[model samples]
Target: MMKYEEEYWIDYIKNNELNKKEASELLNLDIYSLMKIGDSLRSFDTGDTVSYAVSYNINYTNYCTASCPICAFYTPYKIKKYEINKPNKKGYELSLDDIKKDIEKAKALNVTEIHIVGGFNPDLSIEYYESLFKEVKKYLPDVTLKAFTIPEIDFISRTHGVSIKDLIQRLKEAGMDAHTGGGAEIFNENVRKLITTPEKISGEKWLEDAKLIHSLGIYGNSTMTYGHLENFDDIIDHMIRLRDNQIDTPGFLSFIPLKFSIENTPLYKMGKVRYPSSGDKDIKVYALARAILGKSIRNISVYWVALGKEMAQIALLSGGSDLVGTAFSEKVFGATNRKTSTSIEELNHLINEIGRIPALRDTFYNLKEYY
Candidate 1:
């Protein structure tokens, strides 16, 4: 067992790389001490610049085959096929016109990124995504298309009988600039089984796909969903795995510690999980992320939609260097019964209120404008 001393941990964070045992010890530190260490680390790694994106989230469909217990956005493709029910309750697939209208709104907002992710709808083929990506590019050629998650890509590959390399190349040809970091709930096998369904890709598969994505010259953010059915050890292990993977592949631009929203989801209704994470726990995850992956993954993103506005600000002060984005049409969090709307003005206000320099960033974390 490692000794727990604030002084020792502080010095370790500053001078040495963290092992899993050391990371677990750091997670037990008091919130204030953790925040202090995390803040210092953040300042050293990224300086005082806090970045955000003028981005729009487009959930192309909610008819999902992977009925993950952690998700409320999906309506179970089986149910959708049998009943053909309404959206937000049963299932919904947005038409090309629907996506076009959403793109129009994003254009009006001058969004730099069009973030798209959705379920593994069996009906949708590679051609569907190809056309969708092409249309999005045609309408807004300047905006970066950061689309698809590891599980989504894996499922599409298996369902459509396409190789991962071929699928990615096709998407790139159709204007997929990057990938999103969803579907990485927890890397631990037992905990993941509790939170998500078997239909979802395994943690190892997720990592493999990420490596392939990076090898293909595409970069994107990575995430770990916490606050449900996981211990400090699990969190530490997750970050370490990500750290090692970043060392190996070097494509992940940011690490996002997503606070699991339990309301309106199966995880809550099944009585397997009890409540959302407390404010302190949320902040600790941010701090721990910095301590563990601060050197490897420089950008720690504070996803405000999962953590509320105030917690988001606190996270920025602690370890987070980015405020995710202004998720214009975010529906997954909305399905969890949380308000999921924000604007560039609101994001800037939130960052300014926290006294960090707010900068508008593109999908690649390149600072486009500073305010």
Candidate 2:
């Protein structure tokens, strides 16, 4: 184990320029000391207030072409068409009407953001998204529409024969406020090849696309799906890549660590990953993220749906500053048998229980109100 003076680590945190070696050393520190340093860094950057968003998750469709081994949400197109009967079939391509209904529900609940992400279905045209965004803006003009991951954008751009630059410009015109941070399972190419399909874009491609998105004056969050096949070094490398990008583009609004949901997925059946990440590991990851990313990425969100409420609260004290979102009607995690849906009152209570002020934020981390 590498040894460093406590004051030295504190100076690095104060300077907010921890390199990979320094970060790795921090990760090896005792859990309590690590959490203390992480919490202190978080306090120095962003004060005691914890933030969340009044947002709804709209999974437009579960019919996917990628069929990644790590995903449980997607249904094979063939199985959906042949094996499943009409009334019993769980897979679906949601119609415009269904999307409109969801938006209306979100609007009625006074939601500030609408998160739209789904499986990579090749059948959906660019016009489908344009029309959907147009109608969503027409219905809820004030709500922020954070849609599509970089991989999804890459897939759609390739399928539609439009440049990604052009696609993003058109979507911006159609009212896409920002992008989500899904599809970034792990940045290490070797691990990605083992878990995700070739249909998914590479991590390098995802970062390039993110730089492009940032160049367009739109900012999006970054994410890493951990606790599956990646080791600590892989996790550190992922955070370092994100840190380097933020250093250049400075467009990432937050870094969210999504704990892998291991149930009912192909990875589970293969007996490669046996259990969900422990609370200890979850807290450590959140802390290491804060320790490494430092001030460049100000927000670290503990995905409540993935970590569950109790662990999520503990994570907030350790390093996380955001509770992700309400995640109303979320389906991706549901396919893995995890529940993240919560009421506004519940969210407020959770944050408050941890002695932090609970604030509702928009897609861009703009504080809407404190309850």
Candidate 3:
């Protein structure tokens, strides 16, 4: 840990020479803290575990300029010579009527939140969402609408020559209630350039965007796209950056660890990239996040698309406190070659299997009860 970052608290945790919170002095935590948090959760679990809620990933467009190597969700994306080709989708954009049907289906299924996300579609604008969000709100105003990423906002701003600040404002005013934390690949530019680009805004930029949204009384989640070109130092640096951001604005409800899926992307084929630790690596990642972030961040979610439901259950026992996305009919994985979605009932069973109760919550972690 000292090799990664030099600090007294980090050294004390490595040496195991201090007491619990004493070692956590100045907000540096270690593996033992993770075990303590898990233990505390267990002690507090009164046979009343929180139920996982209904959420859906809304991919507005399949187009992207990022061309991230580990991504499986782009259309007409240029890939390397060695990677497998993804199936072609005739349509790149999800139509306004299609979005309406999705909303109707989500309402019929009683989804609490619609996680709207997609590529950096140049044609997509505030008007696109205005029509989509207005229709969704017309059908079901109660459902929380979680949408867009910092990069998406940036892309929209660049395409329409609007600032990201105003773009976010328009989206919020239109209907988006929260952010999805997608653009934050890694805070370090060197790592980002390998996957995304330096122009895509740094992790510090992501934190600023999150702060702006949180300042408006809206909440958003944060993420780390791990198991990619990043070194351990870069990965840890990303987490530390998010943690620092939380100190300023604590509205981030959870930290999602995005596992890199290598297929239909340039990095995997052309650059000869590999994700050696795919699923099992998350145990360490989640445990480390819980330890490092300590209790300041309430939930650490295991995204099932990246890690399957069974593995996510294992994560819950290890250190994870939330199941991310909670999506139905997720197209992100399909874009990546692993088309999969889980219903609320399946999520409930998964929570039970992991020895935790499934609690349905809105985009902001507000529990929505069924009377």
Candidate 4:
């Protein structure tokens, strides 16, 4: 254990440009002390306004070829039902009409953002996404259409014989507002290999494509999936890498510390990872995000579906300033045996209950309404 004087470390964290060694040292501070510094930093940078997005999630398909070990949502192509834990959870693909219907429902909710991501389905082509985006824009012309991860983009571009630049340009013309930071599990090569698979894009490839996307005038978020086979050093390196990238391109709007949910996933079933990370560790991860990247990525999102509503509230006080979104009809976290449903009303209540100002925002973190 490292000796830490809380006041000194807090002042140091606020005053100086933190290097990797100093960040590692700060990780050893008491969890409560870390939270104190994180909350203070949050107040200083992002203010007391806690933001949420009125958004809907559209998981176009669960059929995937990239069978990452940490994923619970993917159903690989031609996989036998009985070969998996849940036989009833077979793969299914949604047509363009089905996606339009989802958009109609989202429009009924007056959603300002439409979040779309899915598995790397080999059957879908670049034309499929083009038509899908065209149809979505035809219906919800005003809603911000944030779609696809860097891995998904890379897969679609390579498998369909389209350059990444051409793919993103075509999608932008078809109506892609932004990208999601889903496939960035972690930056450390060893830990990333342990959690994800070869089919998924490499960490280096993810960052390269992200910079390319930023150069195209497209914006996106960043995430680090922690709590599974990753040490403090891995986490610190991940943040630093993202911080450097943001400095280069100025594209990442937020950094979301995604907690690895182990239930019903390969990591859990294979005896490689037995349990979810503790609440103590979870809160500390949020604080660590604040300490490392708070200045660079001002919005640290507390994903309620992964942390549960109560724990997510605690995370808000720790370092988080965004509740992600309502996450209407989310399925990925649900596959991990976690509840993935919440309403705007419930989100507002959660923020107000914590004695913070609740505000709705769009994909770009622009404030929409204050409650």
Candidate 1 per-residue lDDT over residues 226-310, each given as its tens digit: 9999988899889999999999999999999989999988989998778899999888899899989999999999999999998
> Where does candidate 4 have its weakest 10-residue lDDT segment?
1-10
Comparing 3 and 4 by TM-score, which wins? Answer: 4
Looking at model 4, how many pairs of residues clash? 0
Query: All models: lDDT?
Result: 0.89, 0.87, 0.67, 0.88
By lDDT: ranked, best first: 1, 4, 2, 3
Give a tens-digit lDDT track for model 4, residues 1-371: 22347667667777765789988887777788888878988988799999988888999989888889999999886683455566566887799879978988998998888899999887887888889888888888998999998899999988888898998999999999999887999989998899998999888899999999989988999998988999888888898889888888889989888899889899999999998889998888888898888888889999888888999999999989999898887889989988667788888899999999999998999997899
Residue-wise C-alpha lDDT for candidate 3, range 96-186, written one tens digit per residue:
8888778878888877788888876665667987788777778889878887786676667778888767777777777878877777888
Off by over 4 Å in 3: 1-51, 76-91, 276-280, 369-371
Model 3 lDDT-worst window of ten: 39-48
Full ranking by TM-score: 1, 2, 4, 3
Candidate 4, position 351, lDDT: 92
Q: Which candidate ranks first by lDDT, i.e. highest? A: 1
Q: Write the per-residue lDDT of candidate 2 for residues 98-197, one digit (tens) a residue.
A: 9889988988888888899998887788889998999889999998999998899999999889998899999999999999977889999999999999
> What would the TM-scores of all predictions be?
0.96, 0.96, 0.82, 0.95
